[model samples]
Target: MYNFIENKNTDGVVFFTIPSFEKTKLVKHGFSSKIGGVSKGSYESLNLGFKTNDLKENVENNYKKITKALDLSIQNLVFSDQVHKDHIKIVTKKDCGKGIIKESDIKEIDALITNEKNVALTTVFADCVPIFLLDPVKKVIALAHAGWRGTALKIAKKTVEKMIQVYQTNPKDCLAAIGPSIGRCCYEVDEGVIKEFNKEFTNVDEFVFSKGNGKYMLDLWKANQSTLKEIGLLERNITISNICSMCNSEIFFSYRKDEGITGRMAAIIELE
Candidate 1:
């Protein structure tokens, strides 16, 4: 029921989003594609991150492209520091432009939850998963960055818990999307990572696959789905993008595929 279909306009920019999400007039959210923007080389076109070697001017233009396409305000969007932890923060108008437009971003923030309107919550990703949460009933939304470590830390569920605590948002009233990232198809891991998953999840057999030689293929999408379901979100409401960033390197940036030199996409969510 969830598909992150491509959207290419005459301007040469591309983005991906669930059709259902697009239909929700109360919110505007999507994952940007590698196409569009004006960056060159590995950071060519549509690079949204400032930490890379890409020119700041190019990234700034990219942000303008996205915000213009989605009808969002660049200065109102917040960003994440992403330390692979479960840290979730409550956001407000005070955090406007903390990441992109503003020079200072709230450091060490992996996930952000907010009930305020027009304050778009954005999380950066190359191969890391982007989790979007929306409680339409309460008009609350959140965005999270989940790599292997954040997945093991159950950041998705933790974000939900924070919503319930801060906004009284019920999981039943929430719709979630697990955005594109490194899939199990290309995300092979060593014993060090496997041991971490085994310790956090008892049903490792479900998303964890044995590939022999002490190696494993971890399904971060399924891992996050399990985490959300365990927190009481309806199975139907949990939409998985199912797109592997590494596999679709032509359109999305893959840290592994690009050998760590690439652009980052922004998964943005906000109430209109």
Candidate 2:
């Protein structure tokens, strides 16, 4: 079973780490929970997205708390604009602090890959899949945000392809984790969405379940796993944290559960 290990720092901030990534000793990474922060209502603490209506100061504080808890640096954090597309960015040390401590040039990008140590790559999410990738041989790390649109667009596969092109990362030597998000149990989609999936993936039956009335339960976790496998990543190297964000709304931020207006949790990673 692919599972995430729960951890809480002395500051009371809670986050999760992928056991497979932890075993590598190549990076510091975690997915944050909405447990400890200063934001109020709806956002109600640990809202990491600056685009949200949550107070900017509160969001910054939340970053500081999460970074400290993850043993990451707030100043080195680089964020993705995440337009829910398949676009990717290659991050370097010079890109550190963008969208956080400094102004950002990253836009229309949903995936970020980096080989630079100490430069953290982050992507925010609310009821969306967060994909964490690592190549131990190349000492590379990447983070991707895969919502329904991104999933259909094959963002996960594209990210891996970019890594292979730029860093010459071999899929066989990589480890990946599908972080928490809205699960098939809660992710109801219409025929239009399913059509997109059918166009990109041939084994839709493995992850898509019809509920009638033009709606279906789509398993993004399984869909992403299929993407990884299609690119030659071993099934044993990929992990899926089957936790549903909407189901565990108390611990996570779920846009659907909160009816669109809610905070965003972050999936952060940095080479140690």
Candidate 3:
């Protein structure tokens, strides 16, 4: 039920933005796609992941292009460590550029939250769900990288809870989006992952589909949406992109579809 508007800048950098967040005029946010960048071969273009085998120089250039296109300050952007954990970091001005322009001491953080203006928070993805959260009332924005591990740990809920505890954010006043990722149609997992999901979620069947032979297809969008609603986010306020990265590898990066040799897209947001 979530619709994302795609936009192409004059530089040919394609990104997606949520209409709900766009209408608020409280934040500047965008999700990067594979359609733009300087990287070549497997990376092709718009590969934002620094850890990938793509040349570090090309990755840096991609950041510059995307930050400019999204109107985000590359120098002020703080990125998540993204070890698939539920750890959340409260970002400040001093924390700017820790993960990009400078050395980062922000370790093991899968999510980032900030109420400071112009301090963009970013997290990378390749077939992993990117959860964007905005507390319009508090002028706070958060970006979470929820891979299967993070989703099983309820990282989305932890992010909202951290905002509540730190920024006095009310969940009902927040807007959330489950960004593009591998959908159930292509995300097949074994019992090991299913066990983790079962421990954290009660209504597992609603999002987990069986494919026989002990295989299951997990719907991270649904799981994250349910997590947000359980913590008081209104159903109408949460947007599920429903865009499958694996199914649309042309514009999006999918680790599964690319056989573990793909680039990464980024989900970024900042309070304006």
What is the C-alpha lDDT profile of model 2 across 1-272, one tens digit per residue? 43898889888899999988888899999999999888999898899989999999999999999999987889999999989899999999999999988889898999999999999999999999999999999999999999999998889999999999999999999999999899999999999999999899899999999998998999999999999999989999999998999999999999999998999999999999
Candidate 3, residue 65: how far the Cα is off, in Å: 0.5
When 1 and 2 are scored with lDDT, the better candidate is 2
Task: For residue 241, give model 1's deviation from the true position in Å.
Answer: 0.9
Question: Which candidate, 1 or 3, would have the higher lDDT against the true structure?
Answer: 3
1-272 per-residue lDDT for model 3 (tens digits):
43888899999999999999999999899999998799999998999999999999999999999999998779988988989899999999999998788999999999999999989999999999999999999889999999999999999999999999998999999999999999988989999999999898999999999999999999999999999999999999999888899998999989998899999999999888
Backbone clash pairs for candidate 2 read none
Pairs of colliding residues, candidate 1: none
Relative to the unseen true structure, what is the C-alpha lDDT of residue 106 in candidate 2, on a scale of 0 to 100? 90
lDDT leaderboard ranking: 2, 3, 1
lDDT (CA) for every model shown?
0.89, 0.93, 0.93
Model 1, 6-94: lDDT tens digits are 88767878988766566677898889988998999999889998889999999999999988888788888888788899898888988
**Candidate 1 vs candidate 2, TM-score winner:** 2
- Error of model 3, residue 87, in angstroms: 0.7
Off by over 4 Å in 2: none
